[model samples]
Target chain A: MTTEKMIIEIKKWLMEAAGYIRVSLTNELTVSQKSGRTDLVTNIDEETQSFFIKKINQYYPNDRILAEEKGYDTIDSLTGRVWIIDPIDGTMNFVMEQENFCIMIAVFEEGIGQLGFIYDVMKDELYWGGKNRGVFLNEQKLAQPNDVSLSKGLLGMNAYMYGKNIHSAGEIGHASMGIRVSGCAGVELIAMLKGNHIGYISNLSPWDYAAGLVLLDEFGFKYSNIEGKPLTFTKREYFLAATPTAYAEILENFI
Target chain B: MTTEKMIIEIKKWLMEAAGYIRVSLTNELTVSQKSGRTDLVTNIDEETQSFFIKKINQYYPNDRILAEEKGYDTIDSLTGRVWIIDPIDGTMNFVMEQENFCIMIAVFEEGIGQLGFIYDVMKDELYWGGKNRGVFLNEQKLAQPNDVSLSKGLLGMNAYMYGKNIHSAGEIGHASMGIRVSGCAGVELIAMLKGNHIGYISNLSPWDYAAGLVLLDEFGFKYSNIEGKPLTFTKREYFLAATPTAYAEILENFI
Candidate 1:
C-alpha cells in the first residue's frame, strides 16, 4: 500500500481503538502503577495498544511497533515503516479525572513522519496530520497562529517547566501576555491550532509530538528542540512549537 | 426556618441555578467578550448570578452579596447573612473548552461559614461542606489526606505565579514531588480533596475561595494566607490550602 493509504487505514484503526479504550475507562475499575504511584496505567491503555498493534501486524507485518506500557523491540524485517503509539498519553489525568487523555498514533516511513493522529477519547475530537494532507482537527482544516509577537500572544508550558526552569519560563512569559498550562498536551496543541496560544513548549515523548508535529506542518507552524534543531523520534524530551514569527523570536530571546 | 432547612433550600436553589446556566451554555449560541479578549464573561455567568441573587433577595431579603462581575454592595438591614458567588469560576475555560469550570457559592452568617457549594456542572458533581456537615463530592464523603510530606505531595499553582514569583514556586516545587496547575481553582480544589494534590496556592478573589473554604473546613484541611494567618472574606490577593500536615510543612519550608 502507498503511504497515504497506510495513513488512512491507521486513522480508521485509531478511531476504533479510541472508542474501545474510552468505553473501558468509563467503567470504574481498579488501576495499577506504571512508573510511579502518580503515573498510573489502566487496562485500557494496554488493551488499546495491543489492539492497534495486532491490527498493524496483520496489515503491515514488516512494520516495527513502539508502544508505551509495552517495551520497544526491533523488527527483524526492517521494511522502513515503524508505528509509534501512546494509547493513553495523559495517564495521570486519565486515572484521576477520566478526561484530558488521548490515544496517540504516528506512522513513520523511512524515518520520516508520514502520518500522525491524536484522538481525544472523551471529547471524540481527532487531530490528524500527514506530510501530503497537511493537518486537520476532525474534518476542518487547521491553520498556524498569526504573526503576533510573543508579548502580545498567549503561551502554553508545563507547570513543572515553568516552576523548575524559572529562567527560561520567565523569558517566555515576559515575551507573552500570559502563560497557561492545562495539564495535557493534546488539549494544548489544539489550542495552539486555534490561535488561543502562539506557542507550546514541553518535555514530550514521541507520541506526544507525533500528531502535533503533523498539524504544525499543515498550519505552517514550526517545531524544534530548544536549540532550534529538527526533532527526532528517538529522542523524547524538550521540544518547542510556535508560529514562524514567534519561533524565531523565542529562539532569539530564550534559547 | 431552621439552619438545616435553610441549607437544604439554598442547595436546591443552587442546583436550579446551575441547571439554568448549563442549559443556556449548551444551546449553541456564540460567545462574545466583555472584559477583554482573554477574559470571557459568558451569558451563563451573568444569567446564573442574576438568578441566584434574585432568589436570595426574595428568600432572605436582608443578605449581602459579593460576586464576580458584580460590585459588592451592603444590605441596609444587615441580617448578618452574606452570600459570595462566582457564577462561573473558570470563565475562560468554559468559553474555550466548555469543561472543568464550576459554579461556586458560599454562605456566611456573622462572618462564619454556614454553607459552601461548588457545582461541577458538566459532571453533575456537587462539592459541598460546612463546619458541622462533612465535605462531600456528590454523595461520597471526603476525608482529609494523610500526613504526606511536602516532598511526596503535589502542589498546584498558576503558571503566572511561577513566572512572576519564581523564588517561592521554585522552593515549593523543589520541596514537592511535582506541581500541577489546572487553570481553575474549583477544579484544583477537587483534586486536592481527592488526594491527587496536597495543596493549591493562588492569587484568588473571595468568589474563588468561598466555596473551597467550606470544603477544606469539613475535610479537616487547612488554609491561610502566605503569612500563615487566617483568611478573611475581604482578602483577595494570596492564599494557600492544604491538608493540615502539609500546611505546616509548607509554611516551614516555603513561606
Candidate 2:
C-alpha cells in the first residue's frame, strides 16, 4: 500500500485508540510496575498495544512489530516492514497527570522510516508525517524551526540525565536559555518541532524515539546516539535531538 | 468596596489586558535586559503593568501598587489595599516561546492577602481566588489537590536551584517521582493546584510568588521559604510550595 493511504488508516486507528485511552482515564487504571516503581506500565498501555497489533495484523499481515508492552520480545530485527510502537510514551504521566502522555507509532520499511505518528491524546494534537512528505501538527503544516543556538533556546531534558549531570548535560543546560522536563519523549519532541524548545536529550529506547526520529528529520532537526553514532534500535541508548546548530554544538563541546 | 465587587472589576481589566498582550505577540517587541542576559523585559510587560496601574488608579486611587516593571520601589509595606503585580511572570518564556508566561496580580489589605489572579494569556486559563473563598481556573472551582507524598508525585523545580542542588533539592527531587520545569512560577503553581505536581521550589521575588501564595492558600497547599520560614515579600528569597503532606515531609526531612 502507498504511504499516503497507510497514514490515513493509521490516523483513524490512532483516533479510535486515543478515544479509548481518554475513556479509560475516567475509570480506574490497572497499573503495574515493570522495572521498578518509577518504570510503570498501565493496562491502557497493554490494551492500546494489543489494539494496534490487531489492526496491523488485519491490515498488513507481513509487518513486524516492536512495541513497549508486547511484541517487543518477539522482534529482533528492523529489516523490513517494522512498526515501532509506544502505546503510551509516558505511562507515569498518564497515571499521574493524564495530560503529557502520548501514543507514538512509526513505520519502517527496510530499516528506513516511511511514516511516523505521535498522538498527544489529551490535547488532541497529532504530529505525523514522513521523509519527503513534510510534517504536520494536525492539519497545520509545520515550518522549519529557526536554527537557535544553545545559548538562545530552551532544551528539554530527561530528569535523570540532568540530575546526574550525565554527558555534561548540566553544563550544556547552563549554556542554554533554560532546560525543561515534561517526562514524555513525545511532548519534548513536539516542543522541538514547534520551536518551543531547541533540543531534547535522554536515554531512550527504540519505542521512545522511533516516531520522533522520523518527524525531526523532516524539519531539519538532527538526532543520534549521544556520541553522534547511529542508533541501533536494539537497546536503550543515550539520545540527543536538537536543531542543526545546537546539535552540533552539543556534540562538539559537551558530549 | 467588597471583595466580590473588586474581583468583578479586576477580572474585566484582566481580560482586556490579556487581549492587549495577545495582540502584541504578532508585532515586534521592544526587548531589554534587566539583571543580566537571563533577566529580560519586553514592551508588553511594561505596557501591561502600566495598563493595570492606570486602571487601578482610575478606579481605586487610595490603593498602593507594587509591580515588576515599576511601582515596586514606592511600596514599603503591604498595608492598606496594596496591589502586587508581575506583569509577565516568565519573561524569558514569553520572549522565547511566547507561552508559559502569565500576568499575576495579588491584593493585600493591611498585610492580609485578599484576592489573587494568574492569567496564562496564551492558554487563556485564569487561576483566581482569595482567602476563605474557593479558587478557580476560568469558571471551574478548583478542589483541594490530593494529599500526595513526595515519593508518588511530581515535583517542580527552578532550573538554577535544581542544577545547583541547593537546599538538598536534588535529594528531594530524587525522593519524588520526577521533576518538571516549566520556567514559569504561575505554571508550576497551577500544576500543584490541579494535583499535577506535588510541590514546587525556587528562588523568587515577591511578584513572582505573591499571587501564587494567595491562590495556593485557598487550595490547601502550604508555602514558605525553603528553610521553612515565612515569606517576607520584601526581598527575593528561596520559596517552596507543596501539598500538605509533601510540605511537611520536605520540611522535616530535606529542607
Best by DockQ: 2
10 residues in a row with least lDDT, candidate 1 chain B: B70-79
- Docking class for candidate 2: medium
For B1-255, candidate 1 gives per-residue lDDT tens digits of 787887788779878987786677658645566656656676778778888888888888977898886555223332487888888898876765566788898988787788898888787888887878888877788776675667766677766666556438557755665676666889889878777778888888888987888777777788987668877566566788887888888788777
lDDT of 1 by residue, A146-236 (tens): 7667766667887767655643865676567567766678778877877767888888777777767766777788898767887766656
Question: In model 1, how large is the Cα lDDT of residue A70?
Answer: 59
Local error of candidate 1 at residue B209 (angstroms): 0.7
- The TM-score values for the models, in the order shown, are 0.80, 0.98
Cα misplacement distance, residue A27 of candidate 1 (Å): 11
Q: What DockQ was computed for model 2?
A: 0.77
Q: What C-alpha lDDT, on a 0 to 100 scale, does residue B26 get in candidate 2?
A: 90
Among these predictions, the greatest TM-score belongs to: 2
- The alpha-carbon deviation from the true structure for residue B130 of candidate 2, after best TM-score superposition, in angstroms, is 1.3
- Report, for all candidates in order, the number of backbone clashes: 0, 0
For model 2, the stretches where C-alpha displacement exceeds 4 angstroms are B71-74
Model 2 chain B: lowest-lDDT 10 consecutive positions: B70-79
lDDT of 1 at B16: 91
